[model samples]
Target: MMHSLAVRVYYEDTDLAGIVYYANYLKFIERGRSEWLRDLGIDQAAMKENSGHVFAVRRIEADYLRPARFDDLLSVETALVQATAARIVLDQTVRRDDAALFAARVTLACLDGSGRPVRLPKGLAEALAAG
Candidate 1:
């Protein structure tokens, strides 16, 4: 796995009926992937300062399977499904304990200042692999 992050749904994270808002799950998954990269010494700001590169979500196809509720402790699991010179595929899942609530397959790209594609930094691709 790339990395996993635990998140708790607060009242602010939920709808009036106590169900988590759909958009919040996307926020959780995004944080999971960011933390995964941080674990590998990849800081978006530092990457730009040092190498003039940054990573961006080029496309995403996500599914919301079940509704999460307030106070539910969920885990966001991230894994690298594939990689190329300029792009990567990340598989992410959100689970409440043992129950899966949502999932996504995100296609991301590395880009320079102009937003054009650029090759991933050396070792970045290797680090994205599951252990």
Candidate 2:
């Protein structure tokens, strides 16, 4: 199943040409991922404090299909594509209604405080799978 979040383009999200800056698409999907985890009862800060684990974006493959302009209302659709002991992969898209404007495959790695790879919390894996 896919999870979604709504985003309204702010002027700051745009360039002088009125289209959203290329980098901001990453921001939009990042929010989608964070909210998805939040809704699944994951508190990132608490996870870090309790488990000494943090999630880092290890890789991203993105395609910008079209431009989103200032004031455009968009939805970011996200779904888990895969999960491993130390990594999670997500498929995400930014859309206007049914039109896809951007798409990405993001890989997140679980890391210890010392920045070494670590297993994701068990509860996190279960929750993400269920969600």
Candidate 3:
């Protein structure tokens, strides 16, 4: 039940040494998570507008295992590891071929328009549970 996205490393993704900047790995996984939700028919904007709820990152436990260089084609994979009423935990990885370059355990919290923690929408909870 892994959701994956393909990303090509560009010159802009690289640091002065020509390897991808460490922080950019977070960006790559963020895109992967967005696509994963989209694939599940969850629209963040719609959720915010209709349900008055939005998602925010609560924590991330990340590991930098290897370096990805410019021009590399990478795959970001995301899977739901756990889900609760107010939070979801995901395991994500950035890989080049068979090698893992980065990995993270991400916790996302659902929040109301006022930024107060709230329960996840039933649809989102069900989708993750089914997966």
Candidate 4:
């Protein structure tokens, strides 16, 4: 399943050139992933509180293709690429209209409160698989 979130580039999101700063694309995609999990009925806060488990980015391979200027309406699209006991892989893209501005493959690891790797919650794993 694919999930998309809308983002508007504000002045703060841009650099002196009035174009979105490269790092902000990561923020956009992060929101996309969070919303995607929410849509799948995964409550991150509850999971962390109840199970002491949280997700952290383990790796990211990103490509910046085009520039997004201030005030541009952008869409961040996220899709699950794979899910495992301890990790999930996602493909995400930032687009303006139909044009892809940035793309990334992100790997996220489930971690315990102690910051040690842990298996994903059963419900979350199942939800991701079903989706």
Candidate 5:
């Protein structure tokens, strides 16, 4: 099963045309990824204090299937597409219930303070594999 979260479009999330701005799609996908990790008991705050490591988006490819209008309650679904020693790929989608409005694949690399590549916490890596 995929990790899911609901995002209600507010005026701040939209453009002058009252549609979700193209770039904010990334934020929705970020939320999905955050919750995905949270579900597996990965505490982002604790990670930083203990490991000095954080996950950073290394790549993203998006497809705008349709427009999501203001006030639309959208579901952001995220699944682990791949996970390796130092990175994870997530298949993220925004849907209005059953209708997909946007989709993307996001690759995030685990990094140290200087942005050098680092392995994900061993437990989190195993968690992704289990999923």
Candidate 6:
């Protein structure tokens, strides 16, 4: 399943040139992923408190395709590409209307409080698999 989130580019998200800062694209995609998980009924805070595990970015490959200006309404789309016991791969894209402004492949690892790799919690794994 693909999930989409709407974001409005703010002045603070841009550079002096009024174009979105390159790194803010990452933030937009992160929000997309967070909302995606939320929609799947995975609560990160409760997962952390009950299981002592959290999801952390393990890798990200991103491309800045075009410029987004302040106040532009953008849509960030996220989809799960693959999932494993302790890792998941997702594809995300940011678009201004129908034009793609950015794209990324992100990997996340499940980690214990000690920062050691751990299997995803049972419910999260089930949710991802079902989705």
Off by over 4 Å in 4: none
Provide the RMSD of all predictions against the true structure, rounded to 1 decimal.
1.6, 0.9, 0.6, 0.5, 1.0, 0.6
State the C-alpha lDDT per candidate.
Answer: 0.87, 0.94, 0.96, 0.96, 0.91, 0.95
lDDT of 3 at 31: 99
Worst 10 residues of 2 by lDDT: 122-131
Ranking by TM-score: 4, 6, 3, 2, 5, 1
**TM-score of decoy 3:** 0.98
**By the TM-score metric, which is better: model 3 or model 5?**
3
TM-score for each model: 0.92, 0.97, 0.98, 0.98, 0.96, 0.98
- Cα lDDT tens digits for candidate 1, 1-23: 55889999899999988899988
Tens digits of lDDT, candidate 4, 19-50: 99999999999999999999999999999999
lDDT of prediction 1: 0.87
Residue ranges of candidate 5 with Cα displaced over 4 Å: none
Evaluated against the true structure, the overall lDDT of model 3 is 0.96
lDDT of 3 by residue, 9-106 (tens): 99999999999999999999999999999999899999999989998999999999999999999999999999988998999999999999999999
Clash number for every model?
Answer: 0, 0, 0, 0, 0, 0
Candidate 1: which pairs clash?
Answer: none
Tens digits of per-residue lDDT for model 6, 32-127: 999999999999999999989998999999988999999999999999999999999999999999999999999999999999999999999999
